[model samples]
Target chain A: MIFRSLLAALALMFVMSTATADQRWQRVEAVTQALDNRVPELEGLSLELPLVAEDGSSVSLSVSFTGSLEDGEHIEKIRLFAPGNPRPEVADITLGPLASPANIATRIRLSETQQVVALAITNQDRAFLTTRDVRVTVSGCLVGGGDASAMAMANPRLALAGSARPGQPVTVRSLINHPMETGLRPDGQADDSIEQQLVESLTATLNDEPVLTARFFTGTSANPYLQFQLTPEEEGELKLAWQDQKGEQMEASQAIKF
Target chain B: MGNLFSDHLSAVLWAGALLGVVYGMIAQWSRFCLLRGLFNRWQQNDSRRLRAFALAMAVALVSSQWLAWQAGINLTRTPYHPGNLPVVALIVGGLLFGYGMALANACGARSLVLLGTGNLRSLLVLLVLGIAAYMTMSGVLAEFRLWMEDLYRPTLPATDLTLVTAPLGLDTETGRLVLAGLLSLALTAWALSSRAFRTSPRDWLGGLLIGLLVAAGWWITGVLGADDFDPVRLASLTFVAPVGDSLQYLMLSTGTSLRFGVTVVAGIVAGSFLVALLTREFVWQSFTSPGHNGRAIVGGFLMGVGGIMSIGCTLGQGLSGFSTLAISSFLALAGIVAGSRLALRFSVGSSASH
Candidate 1:
């Protein structure tokens, strides 16, 4: 009887492995279809993810490129897809002309260990892809609690790394402690569909000249955070303003001296 | 310019290494050992080392609070301040660790320092300890550890000192401040109470320096290392997991990047080696007998398992976790002391053995 059970267990393991492989291929196919069936060049695109993540609520992810784009050609859109998340489509970013170099960093919620894919589209109609395997052991917000809108703009936190100087590059990181409800998920408390509320826009200006601006979607992770670089022409007040989908606008500024 | 995570990650690793080197040097120069403090106090009626440990804790508490106030760090979110308490695991692990340290003659951090000073016995202790810690952390013993966590885990209304006082109508920050202040004051008084301890400048300096370094660690991981997109985990001086991480990093360096904990492990050894060389304390030493090697091996293995189960070692729990005022830290500390006293009673027949 024990020998038979062992044989059964081995068969079960083989079946499970094959099932997982099929799912992975399906996710890749889905991403390829989203990119208009074009097989994206794997070069020049790099996806950065921690090998192991304890908290699935807010895992940091970055998509960067070195030599993917031709001269005068820039990346127009970047989409982050996590096969193991509640929603496969994590975030779709539309970059305007003034968007800081093709590198972008943001946080996303992962449900479990799975393959994460980043696909980028250039203005020249070219598609590129990069993929990473992330292992998430803990679930961050499987059950959504608390009201995301109650304390919408109470505390807006910011971390500035690298010295801020004229002609010197500085990285600005900002996180507004807000539960970005996607309207699709239910708030476990009352079984009510949480309204789709998210930070719709972020704009940064140096001495009143626009340096960076971004638009986010419902798929953007909670406590929306963004990190970008700026090399100032002259030291002045760096203003960061965020306007949520609710049309609630919050602003913070820091004086940068040259 | 490059991947911001990698950029800041390497920055955090380099910073961790520098801080670690400093720690190793100071630890060797001052002869700082947490287990020794307790053993000496009980066995020889000497309280100098104990006073140093107390002074370090007191200083760390005040400075960490100050950093939180300045940097706007919420200590509540740190790993040490988790909402649930694993009662059985902590008590059992802490007891095993205390008894192990007694047999081994040093804690994990001390073993690293001793290893740098050319003590081959410490090398063996650290290897066994690291492997055992990894076993309990993610290896064969992980399932057992998970079962213990699942069985004994109890969610508290709050995990820190604020839980008891929060219901009494005090706000969290206020409650935390009052509690931390009282504890720091009491510790400082005790450290200064003994005339012999008071006159020992080395003890006072060691305590003060180690305390400030612990606070500095919080700032590194919490403030400078804090990035909204990819912030490093908020942690301070801890020896158990880091030793295991150091070993793992050696094997999986390509697949995994260095973290604050792993760098600190490397730093402590590097720093200790440099100091030992400068002070002419770098003598090659090994186990005196087969029996001695067996004792060290057993003690190190127990410490590794205990450290993982409790989630911190003497430095990790006794200082870093204690600084946060986590209730689990206190429970683990009590368990450690009880275990140490038990070992003194049974193993050596008296407290005066070493």
Candidate 2:
């Protein structure tokens, strides 16, 4: 009987150890898979993000693309993916001819330390890729309870300015108010989590032609602020529309004289 | 439709000029000094100077809170709050800065005034402080700050200490305002009741004016400076980054945009010069020894690094942060006082030594 009991104990220990090691390996594999999946076009796109963000919510991100775009051939879209997030898509923008070749700035939310991927697609349908490892130090998004959602919502504001000269840089600024909720937050209880509902996309147009676009994630501020430059051929009306996960949308239009 | 006055660029510039004049006038009147307040309390039995500072803090807290509540302004959006606690950095940085302020015999804002009055020592300190601050903010010291953050990490959900109290079922905003106001009033009353304090209208006026300047700073950046495409950094008059910013502006005026703090720093110097010259206070001054100059330089560097690390100087954290009623600012202010006390205890000519 004693010999039988010792054999069983040894077997249990071995099984448990193997299971733990397997779990660790799985996590490592997930990280590796995230890194391996990165598209290469990101090499030409300079990404400026904090190495370690003090607040995971509304972390500032600035991206500048260096490669030349021929006439009628522009970056059709740029998509950002955060692998660790429940909903990995952070932001996606479809850039038109009028948009600047090099710059886009916005804020986004991160659920945790994970790989952030940026995929830039040109009008020719060629895709460029970049991936970065971002560590979320501490999250500052969800501080209070039911009131947080209310407090986070803000009235969207828009501003536009540029010189009347053709191909001159026209600056556009847009502000939106929303919590950009990440589904990962605990809902008062340990087991319950808040469902993510946030602004998913934003698009800007100069004279009805797309000039800039953005995809947003929970990392965006309660009132998301974005600043971008466009080189419009001629001055006309600038239209901006934002869409969120709840199917809520807001639009603002401004007439540009220059 | 947009002339120079109506144009956004000109409006901002004019606003900046106006702000500069106001700050200069107030600073000239108040003789505000974080070092003086804390140092006097430590070195002498006098707490009146300290009380005056508390009065400023109380006024700042009540007024700022009132403005936010009334105008629907979110004070937390500013750098003072950042909606995070930053406990370790605040306390540690504050203590180090407080010591340096004492040794230098003034804080950043005070040093600025002293510099205007032909205080050669202050000039040396200001240069060192500015360079050191830049080092900590973006240069060599940044690496160390990052490493330390990773090492002695706290279990804060977010670094904003207000979050701690918010969860405890207290009226977060109201509680803060009331607490600050009561403290300020109590301190002010105590100071004013004393005959010595009552007689010094010049000092009292200086404190009041400086207090107003703190409020003006918030309005400029938070309200008028708000632009969608080229948003000004949400800030007030804090010496650490501002000093570095001033230096950068001098070097790269065309490249970089002018900010409120930088403009304010410039304005203060110019304003002070005008005031001093008009008042027959301007005089050239210089130090005798290279060693003395070196000490001034080192002291300035310490003030810069310490201020950045703490996130404000005596004026920056003491007045601006305190006005916001940020918990981190309070912790930093305490640290400044403690550090100053320690320096006083050790220094040969320290008032306490006498």
Candidate 3:
């Protein structure tokens, strides 16, 4: 009896696994829309997301690309898409030479249980892809912590981590406060006071050299957080700046040493 | 950006497992269960077990509150404090869970302990309960649960011990101390007042260990697993959702990461089985008749759906949630007690027969 039940469970799992692989990515419009109806190969890209999210409002996600490319070709940018959210345009990250080992991390809002896809576009216009499914239950995507006031966006935070030689880049993380107001407020508590605004763009510089640029959309969680690799060839201050929808900008920096 | 615990989740999971093993052993030794305590207190006119439960609550409260005081952990980040307190879900869910507890003849935590001792009936109860919990939590019945919760969303924005003193012009720090101190003292004094409980070192020792285990739960997930980028969920002992998590983990190991709750559940069973073997309490047991099985099935369904509706079970809301001093915990606790009392008075079959 136990063996029969185990066999039945295994059979059911086989069907589910096949279904997950066959249908999910083929149907997501965001990936095909960016690649112009061509599905990107999942050869050299990886995405990390919790199978079950702690809180769906601000779920932490990381995507990285390490695929070899033809000579004179570099991976220029990577875009994130949460097909489940109201505003699916998650983020667009443009990488520079200083951003070694193209990797990016941030928090995004998921409206429901769905697959999130990452599309990495190279300088040659070739795209590589990876995706992960996150389950968001009833207790998901609720009102996040912190106030929605304009002043709430004041105290931007930046930090550095990871060990590398002076010529090599270390991990750079930055957080700036903003509601990422998607124009659709589920809670409606701060609907009146909070305007529909987000930190549209962010740029980082090390020793006055451009390192990273990212475009944030409404799908980004409140208090937009981001992490990427930045090279510290010479010892100087690392600066991070944020620009909101109204063209308002915020800046924060930290010292870098070998 | 999220590497500290994310990189070493196995270590955190191991800690949870160790704690679960400790809890299971202690529970087996004490036969620590709220249902058993209630049954004995009301049906047999003995309150020794009930007092032990109270003592456990007291220790958990004092220790968990101390952690919060020291900023060793942030209690406010927990799910017990949603924006709109779902008062309706609490009463309905708690009542169903209580009734289910009486019908199934064991609560979620108790059932796990029983399963460790080779009770086949507990296996059935756990499977149904886990499925039902997932049904209400994220499955087919989720829509209905969400609708009911949204229909009646009128309640205090945030209800905790400080709610009492906030209106009385006392600061939050003073209010937490004043309220938690009085309640903890009253509970401890009541437990100690019972000569039966005081005389039984084994009973009080169970209470102490379980309480410390709950606090250690918070420490493992909240403090030791604390990471700004990849923070672990602030949770302690609660069996309703964790059981479902364990079931999901069994099937979807490749897709998902191992969570603390699932590991805790696994640890509890192992720990209980170890103690049961050492004590020679490992005896195979099954339902006597079909009626007994049917009744337990109903009980399991109610517990699964109800536990999710209320967002916790006896251990989840009654002890772990209570330690946070959240007011919603009190309402759920009251509902559960009332439901169990109703079931005890009106249940058709004998509770002890199963």
Candidate 4:
């Protein structure tokens, strides 16, 4: 029995050491799947993250791409992944032609000390990637183990900036407050009891035509906040719609005259 | 049209400039240089200036602690109290900065004040220092700085001394308050112990007021500077990065918006120039010789690199970082003292030496 126990203990140590590396491999595989199994160049993408995070609930992250786009190619989509969370995919952002390459910033919920990766896909089906390791300590805000608070469904708020000039880009900032309970969080009892209830899909529309859309996962921070630019061809009311994992929807709209 | 003067970022910038002006004026009035304080205390057996610094530290400690508690500001939010300890970089950087200050005869903060007083020598020092700082911070030398930072990085259990009292069953606030209070008391007592320091009213005022300003810096950045949608980066007075930032801002104003650090640096120059004019202390000063110029260049470069590596200069690490009671600050303080002592010992009153 003692010999068996020693072997089990040694196995545990091996598993513990290799866990992070395994997660990293898994992250690459997930990104590959997202890119239709096309291997990325692994350059030009700059993923910025603090080496150590004092807060797990709301850690700021930014990514920028540096390489020049070819004559016939532009970035199609940029995706963020936090593999340690219940859902690895954090955000999927589609860029307009005028959007600056790789300029994206948002907060993420890190389940633990884990690697975050950003993948940028070009129109030519080429991919560029970058990664950063963030160490999350004892959380600075809400610990992940209390009773999942009832989705208060805090009112969604929106701020519109820049003149709504026809054919000119206008910046829209919006937030919908929610606990964003990951299915992996404990519920004051056993761990991994809280069911995930995150703002899953967000869309911005002008004159009932989709301008921008994003799909979020548990890694998206509590009280999901997003900022994006939209160019309107004519005067119209801009609408932002959000849907949670439970199919609950909340939105705020602002009228813009061009 | 966007409003010109009432946004939170602008408010914070203006507050920073005002605070910087006060800092510049006081530093000029009191001749506040840590190297000079050490030199006077060691070589001349005079402790007044050193006492003033100690008192400032005490005041900064107690009041900043109180502010953190009252305002619900997490000290760990800033880089100085980050849980990881970059031991090697702090020690080497602190030593270099200390030694450079000895050779240059002023810390980065004092260099600004001197520059305002028409000291062309300080202008050279500031230029070299700013470029070197930027090199270490984000330019070519950043690779080496990052390598050194990661060489033997160890994460501490807690970010501060409160970790020490945790196992003893004391809560974090209780532990923090007890430790901070005792340290403040001890330092305050030491500052007041010297009768010479007690008699120098200017020194007393300098220490007390500077301490208050340090605490005020926390409030301005942490409280007034905070915004939900677009938060200003929480920081206080640290000359190394700000000096580099100021130089960059002058060149990149059209591309980059004004920030608290850049504005504060500008305020220091403006305030110091105004004070020098008011006090008639402005003089076009230059190096005594090419040897002196060479020494200033070397010293300035070392200070710039060292300050960036250490994450602060004397005032940055010794005063601002110390106010938070971070263990890394203590290590930095020790390294700086050793470096300063080494420089002082080697100088031998040469013309090239300060």
Report model 3's interface C-alpha RMSD after superposition on the true interface residues: 4.8
Best by DockQ: 3
Q: What is every candidate's alpha-carbon RMSD to the true fold?
A: 7.8, 12.4, 6.5, 14.0
Query: Which digits, one per residue and each the tens of the lDDT, describe model 3 over residues A1-258?
Result: 999999999999999998777457667676668878655778898898878774577788999877788886767888999877766789999887777678899998887888898988887788898888888753344442223334336668888776646767578888875667665645323355446677889999878888889999867887799999876677877888899888888899888876
How do the residues B113-143 of candidate 3 rate in per-residue lDDT, one tens digit apiece?
Answer: 9899998898888999998998887678876
The alpha-carbon deviation from the true structure for residue B3 of candidate 2, after best TM-score superposition, in angstroms, is 6.9
* Global CA lDDT computed for model 2: 0.66
lDDT, candidate 3, at A15: 93
User: After superposition, which runs of candidate 4 have C-alpha atoms over 4 Å from their true positions?
Assistant: A1-91, A94-225, A228-258, B1-4, B348-354
Give model 1's clash tally: 0
DockQ for all candidate structures vs. native: 0.16, 0.08, 0.25, 0.04
- Displacement of residue A140 (Cα, Å) in model 3 is 5.4
- Could you tell me the TM-score of candidate 2? 0.67
TM-score of chain B of each: 0.96, 0.89, 0.96, 0.96
What DockQ class does candidate 1 belong to?
Answer: incorrect
TM-score of chain A of 2: 0.72
**What is the full ranking by DockQ, best candidate first?**
3, 1, 2, 4
Expressed as tens digits, the lDDT of each residue in A41-134 for candidate 1 is: 7788888988876456677888877664678797777888876655577767665444446677888877667888888888888988877888
Evaluate residue A157 in candidate 4 and report its C-alpha lDDT on the 0 to 100 scale.
79
Candidate 2, what DockQ? Answer: 0.08
Give stretches of model 3 more than 4 Å off. A1-60, A69-73, A107-115, A123-157, A174-201, A221-225, A242-252, B1-8, B155-157, B348-350
| Tens-digit per-residue lDDT, B24-100, candidate 1 | 99899888987788888888889899899999999988898878888898776666665467888888889988888
